[model samples]
Target: MADLITAGRAMSRRHLLAVGGALPLLGACARAGLGGGFPAQTVRVSAPFAMPDIAVPDFRGARPFPITTYGASPDDQARTSAAIRMAIAAAHDAGGGMVVVPQGVWPTGPIHLASNVNLHLERGATLLFSDDPHDYLPAVQTSWEGIECFNYSPLVYAFGCDNVAITGPGALVSKLDGWKPWYARPKPHMDALIALYTMARQGVPVAERQMAVGQNNLRPHFIQFNRCTRVLVEDVTIHGSPFWTLHPLLCRDVVIRRIKVRAHGHNNDGVDPEMSQNVLIEDCEFDQGDDAISVKSGRDMDAWRLATPARNIVVRNCRILNGHQLMAVGSELSGGIENVFVDNCHFIGDGKGADGWAVPIDNLLFVKTNERRGGHVRNIHMTNVTATRLRGSVLAVETDVLYQWRTLLPTYVRRLTPIDGLHVANVRVAEAKSVCTIRGEREQPVRNVSLRNVTVEQLSGPAITTDNVEGFRRDG
Candidate 1:
């Protein structure tokens, strides 16, 4: 296969399988040069990142400061927020140590983690977060959506800290009975959005762009790491979130692995890595209401002002049970995104009934942008994935998904998102509406898309649909 995939080798969809399947050919093409369905231009495919090797801290030599010792008891139904806070402080005070939550159901309020602290929950432990918004009072500096604002605090938050960790086999659940009602984009929410848009456009200082003091009523993220470094989250199961579940915003050197999240509320993405770099997400299971994993920077003028791109990220060995899209790249990617690799992942429906593949995935990979967002997305690679029961297209790239923002807010800049250098290889789906759909604006056409060895057993629509694209090829 390597010998056959020389430079300028042409292979069709059927020819790909006739030559003993396409994995070898796809891989060979990547190594030798653009072959099969790749574009004529030289596209640089990136390898997995090696720098920023973040590792979980070993607290073996350190002492464990149990929350129970800090006035927490499972026998009482009252909130254990204060006790947990005290325990975390004690652990940080003693150099670095583990703040332990013993095996029990502890209903708690917001938990603000400090630097050099490992918040570990023992087996059978459950931290049920309060629903009342007041529990997350004195809102910290957190972003809502992709715009910066001070709203309600995240359920578990770490701001301007380093070397933080959240690990356990237990569950951190959000009592969404209170936040579920806030999902509606009410007048207040839209008003806040307009205010934030105006502020970011007018170059208002982020410190003064405050929404916490008003009735703006924007929901907070579940777990957010803001401006922190060397973060790790592992082996925890999170259930039900008010907004994006695990958001590592403006952080560096992060590793999230072996975690499970099932958050089906509105905008409840499993992981939203926004404006962060050198991150790795592997062996995670996501059943989300929005995109399973949405890579974002900031939005519009806000992102332009921040001037940080989400880069050097890898997502592999993950399972996508349900979501709007398996992996989505913005409508909020105004700060640009680059060098992303998603490999060796599994996509299935909700694991229910007899075979555990009953649910259907809407789309596998979706890239969305609009005229208001002027970002550049480049060098994306995905390979070696198998899925069943795909109700929508296998791939979609749309550039006009403004939702209500098309009219709600004026386009501060008429710039369009430039998408280029995307590659996918060796993927198979049992059923899908179409192989792919590309809808690029006339002003900014999607460019340099390559697909190799992708097959759908049944397609309900045309094999490919496109409005405007350049250098798009699909082979095998």
Candidate 2:
């Protein structure tokens, strides 16, 4: 039995207008867009409002220090990070200004950001990170694939800060030796340490886990900002993330634009924004291992505790060359998610790699809730999305009971979690091997799912299927 109900709020007029206006601009700038051929410009002087704007701060009044004089060595990492931290502190101590990383290859460990600090790297500067796993040791509170875990600190990290920016036209590299895999620990002790940390975390209370600081033995993210407001990360190239890259969690008014992420390590997601509001992600390119843009929330019981929805988020004008999924929502949607919009994106699937993976490419827009943490997903709009090739379904809304049992039950399980009020429109896929499946639990049905103006060339299975869905609608 399937049910369809117009039970929730509709897309706001302002949102629709924004989406309508942005689509044509995205089409015009498709392949030969900004930054693809344009000459380098100062961050502040560049189009801060434009799609590929490089935000260079106007430090006209501040004294300038050339970084070429700084020596480069493995030992310089700690010193450079320390120097940057100190510089930011000094700037804040005497009002505020930018902390610049001038041209040079400076090695660094974990770098923390302070409020009113702009960690700007110049054109020739390369912020190279040490590959030693120990450098990221003593894990911190962070999210891995959206689940709250104690993991290694990202290359750049900030928390509870306002007016922070990581802007430059520089390249940031992770010195990953080919011999040692980026995701695997070099020594058995590191693995043991992670396991020990996880076990210790299991003993702690759920509330404490949320508030705890330090890495949570999980994979490291390239850049992460939590509980921050008014943040900007622009015009940077991030390479060889040991884990997921560029995560902004629980933040407001955040903008990530004109960033290039190239990572192939296990679970190296390009960008993940969880429990955040008013985020704008634009003009980014991703060649990653996992989802290019994944939206998530707290996992298991912790998700319920947080109960904060990721609302009013927008993603536009991005290109995904190769990734697990072009865009994804929730394997960890314990907290509700709503008012999300994605448009003018391209997904050039890795057909060979796509067929090689075991799990199907779920959906460009995936909404699933576990038995433990079921929440509402509503008001999703995708417009002018183009997929060259897809090995899986165009869309999949499923509640995997087995996955829930394996992941959610052992820790904390809840029942009657409903995934409701989903709408997808203007989705087009050139080719696919499987049908778009929409499913829900037998007891708790998936309700009010609608698809409009969707066109798929090839589908191997049913266009839509459900175990028990209520009020499902499909239009043209």
Candidate 3:
């Protein structure tokens, strides 16, 4: 609103909204019965779990450091990348600043952010990333699916930094020439994944679990804020990511608002907030190849070792153009996920995209887990969600969602994820295959699930289906 960052001093959340001009044309927050909560000036969540106020990062007294002064040009990728790195370093050294990318088509490689730096892009700017995987060489610590490994660096990466942001009305476009071939899961890729999983299972040091060498085609994330605090990503458009679009891993007090993502690549989820706390994702639009917002903790032995569950996350006022699910909570969650609230979101129907191809969504809220994924999912709530059409059920919970890893490897430890306390209210679906489906395990049945005022106009199957579910209820 206030240009994302004002000139002289840092602005509070209230100040940012107060001085705001006209908001974007994305649909307004859904205000149906028992709904209409948005996250414009604050994170106000009405859920069964306790939610603390998520603090938005304020860059007070931040100076401006333009990359052009450091010899960045629109043409040279090496020089622009170096200039960005230098500008971020200079700004971090100067305590805080806006590392500005002016209006131009700037080609760059990996952008590593530092503390107290707001990588601001002007309205006409486009930071086009190189497709070459080698540009992201010299491996940095990142995650593949859910296991931690030293792989290619994300397009924009930050680690252990506080008060960091990437803002403005610009676009981050990735050239996918290099990543297209690696999307195929060949034998080599499968072998590499097994190796990484074995290493993580054996408690190898994260520094030594490198997968950047050889034919290990573990794709890097587009933007990752790893182990950072007070992070904000706002008002930016992301296109054509290699993997998951925006990932906040083990972070605290993160706010991702007003960002648009149209990444239709393999496994290109919109935002994967894994093992993070106090997160608020609002007013965003996602046209993804995978789930729109997939909330996860960690996976298997790696997650058990970290011992940090994802908690107190809220998503509101977002629009999903196309996705496998409007929202998914973890088949990769071994460290538990709880206190999640999704409110006032809408899903656009099947439609032709900019490329003139039809994209369709599947489910509304899908909670997926497996036998090997030993975690706990509880206190989940969804309200005021309206979808025109869905290929699957409105609410689907599966205890056997291990996609490929099921046949590839045996379960080293037999543990079932316990799911409980799921409530869906004020959901209206125009057409769907079923109203709801819950397939819980016999060992640990899903418990305490309720549906109130949820209606589907045209449904092919039963209104409610359950297997090994306990304490299930339906209300008008």
Candidate 4:
């Protein structure tokens, strides 16, 4: 089961920020047009609040340390993995440089990236991750479904690294030979999930919350930048994933640009920015099994402790071939989300890729939260978006989305999420089942939603439906 929510009328005065597609920063390969050097770049976007300019690390004049020099052999997983590890170390030790993966089909295990390193894959190169679960052993500090735990490390993992990037015209491919079966929600898997949830609620130390043990079915993410600053992922193609495809957790100043992702595995969200700040995602294409871009601020009490909001995020000029939603704002937002801007994006290819992959999208924007989540959603804007089709509404805001967790456990905290300040303009969709659905709570209704020049053709349901919403307005 998937989760989502929607906006109300008239954006709050406090919610005025960005508009076009401009950002000021040093960027990755595709953004800076850098073949091997980091150059200063700027992009502009229009929104409601003051969007901070992201700062990117400078890798200019940096030396290159190719993995082939460290014993990388084609099709050898162990040798290639060792070579990558060694090359990363060498680059980091040199103060900062590119750890280049030359053109070849290099099979490898889980890769741990270091600080001040650019894991660059040349054209025609691919990192075919191993299918064996043991290859990602000794659980690392990670999160599953918003709750923090010590789980199997992501395929490409970076922790607390500064000025890091994974950029090139190459690909990072996952082998689902072993992970495919873990997608099933078996009894053991459900039990493990519940156990982790309960432990988190009870304030269990994250170290003691080891989930890579026997009978646990929690899948690892494909790529995760954990608690890192000045990050970038650019120009690469990703195929398949064990879980959420790209996750930037608690990171600041992250830029993900000009990449392509086709991951239809369970929970394969294209990009999930959780408890992060000042992020820019532009010029990317996504075909995923779940929400294409899911913005989250962490979950429940575990997130409340950190007190960091996922704020000042911008997504521009992206194309969604297929996804559950173009964007989803939290069923796990207990730490709050604010100042998100989406502009100049579109849905393409009739929900089907050229390779025959398809996933039906439910909405353009989905804002979902339950009474158990006590976060606030504010200053969210989407402008100049076009879509061909949608299976559900164009915009949906639901206050009671629990999915499988409704019966698994009782609400540890019954604070309802406060949602406000949503604005949409110049949106055109060919068709959809409904235009908008706002199912807010009576106690604390959603507020200040405005839609200007939003047009949808062949709508099967009401243009707007509201339950406990305030200040909703639509103007041509």
Candidate 5:
């Protein structure tokens, strides 16, 4: 089951704030070109809000700083973790360059990037990360599930940088063999999470929320580009992830294209763009155990304090091989979300693993919030999409998803959120347990929902379900 936050009195958001490709277009061994190739002329991205054409830098004119030249060996030296840092410095010193990881297996700890650096992996090269949590110590600023904290650093992290990228045709594998021994959530994690919740409400400073200081054991994301600009991640095959595979937080002008992600471990969401805007994701393939794509802003009081709503995101030409949901918004959207457009996508469920066992997907589009969420969501549009199979409704909007918070804590009053202007059109679902479920809170009902040219070929349940929804319409 998908778990959302227990709504507390969260802060309200005022504002918030990126690919490519092809040569046959396998980015596996390719490197050195930037501005994504998929624009209005190529991918035929809709101009509903006039999604801007992404600019990928041309690295041909930049310097090349190969890690191997800086004493990084494919052998044990790669694990030393200092050689790659030197290379990133060399690139930054050159005013921007390609920090090349040549063909070989280079083991390392967390990779902290600088502005104008492109970490390019060559084919047959695998950048394997260690499973030890302490390797990412001396916590940098990162969020765990949405709350701001100084926690574990993401494996590939860029903080407050501009014009950074991770590109190549190689595989960036996380050796979770050590960490997986400790399952997704243990007692320590639960206790730590509860502590975070308490501290968030107490108005504790984020730096003081030192989650990485103790046995908190909160996992870090595989890739995080926080407070960045002009970010690009293309053509890499990211197989094993520590947490969310790719997360861009509080960023702008981001582009992700032609990447392949098959990280099925716990909380292995393919990509999460939180408190970000002007982003584009295209030509990517995902096989995850969680939502393929989740757009979020923030969680709880920390989020309310930020008040930066996520907006102007474009997701297209992506294929979901299997996951919990094709796309989802909130449980964490207290800061709010707007102007989202998803089109020309495919949700082909095939979660069956090596032994041929799997979990089925639930919905194509899921918008969820809880009573404690005081934010608003509007201007959501999904067009020209396809879903092969689903165990639940094709589209669902729920105002209450307290999950663990239902029994863990008590709420004084429902700070119901106002949801409106959901437009889904030209959708085809092969099998759906239910066509749609428009659930709204009694205090603030959902409004202005339009589903047109939608056909559920094999709907086993109700065609439409509504609760406190006004101006709901379905057209042929």
Candidate 6:
């Protein structure tokens, strides 16, 4: 046991050192020139675009101020919040320095970010948020289950900012006080919570939610950037989010790289990009309770008003440790989505514990469309994806019904909506318990769906099954 512990410690140290060394290299690569007929106009932010020999840029150089203040006692809510506010102010006054969260157990309330600011944390640094409901007050604009509504403030939020980044080699932990146990709270409080959710569901504006910020009534997300541009988030470890870990909404030219996002909570997706364009996500690791990566758009009429499809997005060279769904595209796709490409990913499903056997994880890829509010999904490509253990179908596509009832509604609105132009290739599943399932409505059946070079080791049912498909083909 001692030897094993020693080996583990050594491995941890080595991993830390390797990560540290790569930072400089990555910085240098970010500035290097890509010469292979790559479009000069296009901005390449992936690791492959980094220069071969140059050192990574020191992030501190890009900042203007130093983190000289520390949050008060871990439990002192007011003091910690004041300190963080001061640090942000100092950084902003200095015309842009990083607000460094030095190595410590600083407990604080929600920390708001400013423009031209970088939230940097060094190794051994930890920013633990308070679990007290009152620490986070007032509802804010957020999404739940892909529906846009008023929710809690994200732990870190920035709206309509330019040249903002949250980069470091540290951890961002959200201490969600045991909201998981509904029984612990009083019945009246639970009823009120349900009422608030119902109001939001009815499309009541978030502004009407009289709840305090960061309260138990509405859950908070880890990192949220809304309608921002030129955003970069890299080299961070985030865990224990009450909701989605990293969510970018209505943003453009964003890059998320080398991030480790892990959380075990209801709807705690690893990364969700909603109503955003020109996104690049690469070299990230996700172990979450929900979908590893989900693409979504607006919901209902509000989504139509947004009218911006998530386009020109690419996700590559990532790993999914354990998630409800490895990759998913929405049931709330009101704004429509297109031009998505996912490549070179590995999914390692959770193994069965005890019982001397293993149960399967969910599907590797899931795509669905809502029936009531019609939308279009097209030009999606997946290549070189490997799944180790899959309990559900390798791929599942289900169109939403027009109404809540399983039965058809009065109008044609609840009819099956069509999804067009999906392509999957080079997909390999080592072990799967069920055949892939695809369902489309009768009228608007899925159109032009193609699968090539797809193989499954073990399948309990038909390898591929589709209902009401318009033009489906499999190229063995």
Task: Report the poorest 10 consecutive residues by lDDT, candidate 1.
Answer: 34-43
| Candidate 2 residue lDDT tens string, 1-476 | 00000100111223234335323322221223222222122322111122222222233454433333233343567677666656666554444456778777888877766555567888987888876666764445566544554445677877666656787899888776721343553434243333333433354332223211222234567788877766788899898787668888887677789999887667778888888877778899987777788887756555666778877677889988777677777776767777777888887655544346322244677666666566667666677677766766667776763341363224344554566666667878877654357777888887787778878877766666666888878889
The C-alpha stretches of model 2 lying farther than 4 A from their native spots are 1-75, 144-150, 177-217, 349-362, 401-411
Better by lDDT, candidate 5 or 4: 4
Write the residue-wise lDDT of candidate 5 on 1-476 in tens digits.
00112211121110000012111111221233322332212223464776665555455566788887888866674433688888887776666788888887898998888777789988887898988887776666789888887677799988777678898899899999866755556666676777777677778666556676445678889999888767888899998887899999998778899999998788889999999988889999988878899999888677888989988889999998878888898878988988888889898765464467455778888999998877889888888999888888778998888876676556744566789888899999898888889889877889999999999899888899999999899999
Quote model 6's TM-score: 0.79
Q: Candidate 4: lDDT over CA atoms?
A: 0.84
Candidate 3 wrongly placed segments (more than 4 Å) = 1-48
Write the number of the candidate with greater TM-score, choosing between 2 and 6. Answer: 6
lDDT of 1 by residue, 262-322 (tens): 8888888999999898888999998877788999988898898888999988888999887
**116 in model 4: Cα distance from truth in Å?**
0.5
State the C-alpha lDDT per candidate: 0.78, 0.63, 0.84, 0.84, 0.78, 0.66
Candidate 2: Cα lDDT at 379: 68
Q: Compare candidates 2 and 6 on lDDT and give the better one.
A: 6
Error of 6 at 188 (Å): 7.8
Ranking by TM-score: 4, 3, 5, 1, 6, 2
Question: What lDDT, from 0 to 1, does candidate 5 have?
Answer: 0.78
Off by over 4 Å in 5: 1-45, 50-56, 77-80, 350-357, 412-414
Using TM-score, give the best candidate's number: 4
Alpha-carbon deviation at 248 in model 5, angstroms: 0.4
1-476 in candidate 6: lDDT tens per residue? 22322332344434445346323322321332321222112345333222121111123466544354544455566776677767766665555557777776667777666655678877887788776555554444556544554455678877665556788898888887644552244544444444443444345554443333222344667788877666778898998787778999988777888999878777778988998888888999987777899988865555765688877778899988778777788766777888788889988655642243322357777787756556678777787899887877767787853323233122323423447877878889887765467888777778888888888888877777889888888887
